[model samples]
Target: MAAQGQAAAGSASESGGSPAASAAAAAAAAFPATSLYVGDLHESVQDAQLFDVFSQVGGVVSVRVCRDINSRKSLGYAYVNYNNTSDAARALELLNFTPINGKPIRIMYSNRDPSSRKSGAGNIFIKNLDKSIDNKALYDTFCAFGNILSCKIATDPSGESRGYGFVQFEMDESAQSAIDKLNGMLINDKKVYVGPFVRKQDRENVSNNIKFSNVYVKNLSDTVTDDELKEMFGKYGTITSAVVMRDSDGNSRCFGFVNFENADAAAQAVQELNGKIFNDKELYVGRAQKKSEREMELKEKFEKNIQEVAEKFQNTNLYLKNLDDNIDDEKLREIFAEYGNITSCKVMRDSYGVSRGSGFVSFKSAEDANRALTEMNGKMVGSKPLYVALAQRKDDRKAKLQVNIFLHGSWIYTTCAFMLFHNSECLVFACMVGEKSGEFY
Candidate 1:
């Protein structure tokens, strides 16, 4: 029922049930439908200006531009009330998207109950407006395109222009026409941006929030300029903007971002230029990632690599300690090969190139490794008892250094500390006498 254009006003009494539906809906509304939402208002617009503009189509009972309580500055939008619903609807059609004081204004039926409102479904968002443009000027510019329901420019608490605003059109065709004709048109020497309006939450979830067609490129030449970057990527399609990151001194950071007017152009640039050698370095071109997302990706990659390495050596590697310094890789393999075929063996060495009295041995299967561990653990070697266990990664070995042994049913307690050596092979046990026993490691 709200989706009406200039024709909708006179045709409200069409034979279909639309008129009845609209009447019934309006009657059920908490507030009278004789109120209109007027947005894209310039910060300088006063209640008098709103009344003057809206009274052209109807007898305006009141006009109010919302303002901050403390600062008393215009909030960039206002509401207009008329004694009759027909007058309100007429005002919405004639004044919407029309320029007032060189700025385009938006008009729509006011629905104070946000839950019942369609939000920005029939609205258009415009940005990059000139600060000096006023509501009247904006309204005059776009009034010809459609029956605008409301127009407004956002403002800061202090009433300064936020350089953006919204316009609500009654009909989808009118809104689309405005978008097609006025998007990218220069206003006050600044190129304006125009698009369909959406809620802030919806805007955030969109994949191309930054731009519909954008690409991130890095490893660029230090000598590259914004113009150069744009020119380079412009081959695929019309370029909108290209910026090379720079330092305060104006030196290029060798990275840049490029935005095209078409998504296919951006995809083509990513495909053709990624890993392409430029300025003696391979370019890293792809979709841009926010700082937080990039950090998370790196962390996940590191963890995945660690897990892969851990799985690669699972069950096949055995840790051996208490070996004599004379043990070489060949002799170590020879001894472990008794149970099954030994794939590899190596005794860790010190700076002097001598064995550190420990080594790791890999068997063909987990069964052979387990058999060797079971049979050789705590068994006598040449001069000392050997300790055999599953070979652990560096992090795992450090974790096992702190062990807590339970001594149940024992009244006496001793503080035992096991000192681990640099190679993680030697363990020296020391104890201090204590009088009472509790849970201790």
Candidate 2:
């Protein structure tokens, strides 16, 4: 019963089953007949019920109502393979709209479309996910268009489910086809929105700019990846690298930056992707600058503030204080020079040129000087701690805390006794009063 030898090369594409009504419409148009996969059959319907209703005007070879692989419950869809093209044509024409068991019967040819036919137009997106839908499901759903290297469904901690996911196919044609056909299709009653996956900026950055050599893109769909981005942008330029950033927790951020090997290529990518719609979102694109540049730029703003303060304190003349006896102004300036411009550093010395244990560090800007003061104050250099408090007048501090007391005759007692004890480095102070020689002495 094998048609192997009799079957020509094109015969496989041409089903041996006859058209139930007519193949003129399909064959004339050169359109291959695809099976009208039926679903939601009433539970008690049988093969006879289906055949009687469908085979009235068409060639009939076999009607196969597939059931669960193990449990064998009616899967609701039946495969009707007709013997002659005419018979198959008749069945579809006659019964596609016929009602059986309160559900209209649809009769189309059966086919298992391989990866070659993803070019048709449709769209796909998935939802109502139980969080268990895995990468294989994602790939299998879209891979029919072409080769798919990998796929993934986002999951939660404790490995639960994130209710979302991404799929990557080797061919853009396949991805496009999936987007077109499945975008609004109802699978499990959930209307899925399918489109190209956009990756996070960070992952894309790592792939192209940080870890790889290419343009980075942000505001990507969480599902976008290295390969897909390459394919999407590959037309624009020779992409040296591509990546979609993933959170440490393993989820894609919404956007990513793309770095092209040359500015020209990156410009091309931005031009092509900007305002372009993928997965229903307009893509954001640009060159990714290194993260450290922002820090340096912001820190420079404070430099002026430091110099302003320093000018008021020293009038541009270095007044060094608290200089370590062993270290001099030359050493002090050298240490602070890395912060910014240093006009001068001169340690104060007494008449004998002895170190005053205090020194001045003069930065060109009050900003830098104050930064040093704030950051370096109280910082210990070797065994000694450096004090960076405002340079106050020496005499002002000495005059602030003076106290005065006047003793009068009424303030004195006749006699007084006091006792103190010391034990193992512990000091104790105590007082007692007693009449010593005269009244209350």
Q: Tell me the TM-score of each prediction against the true structure.
A: 0.34, 0.26
lDDT per residue, candidate 1, 1-441, as tens digits? Answer: 111132433343353644323432333242347888787776668899888888888799999999989858677789999989778766655666677665567666786766434566558888998877655455545555544455667764323577898776656776787777778777777888889998877866784434437688878889888998898889999988999988789998778889888988888888898899977878888876554444444444444544344345466678888999888988887888798888778799989898888888887766577668878999888899999987744444522222223333432333344443322244454444322111112
Please report the candidate that would top TM-score against the real structure.
1
lDDT of each residue in 1-441, candidate 2, tens digit only? 111122221221234432322232443134344333444455456888877765676555666788879856576678776656555554555555456775544343454564432322222334555444554345334434433323445653112345666554444665676566666555444555666654355446655543323444655678887788778887766666667766679897665544556666666676677778887777766555443432233233333333233224432223334557888767777766775677666566789988777666556654455556656777777567777643332333211221122223312221212111111011222222221111121
Please name the candidate that would achieve the greatest lDDT relative to the true structure: 1
Show model 1 residue runs off by greater than 4 Å.
1-212, 275-282, 319-335, 341-367, 374-388, 393-441
Clashes of each: 40, 93
lDDT of each: 0.68, 0.50
Instruction: After superposing candidate 2 on the true structure, give the runs of residues whose Cα lies further than 4 Å from its correct spot.
Output: 1-24, 28-44, 117-441
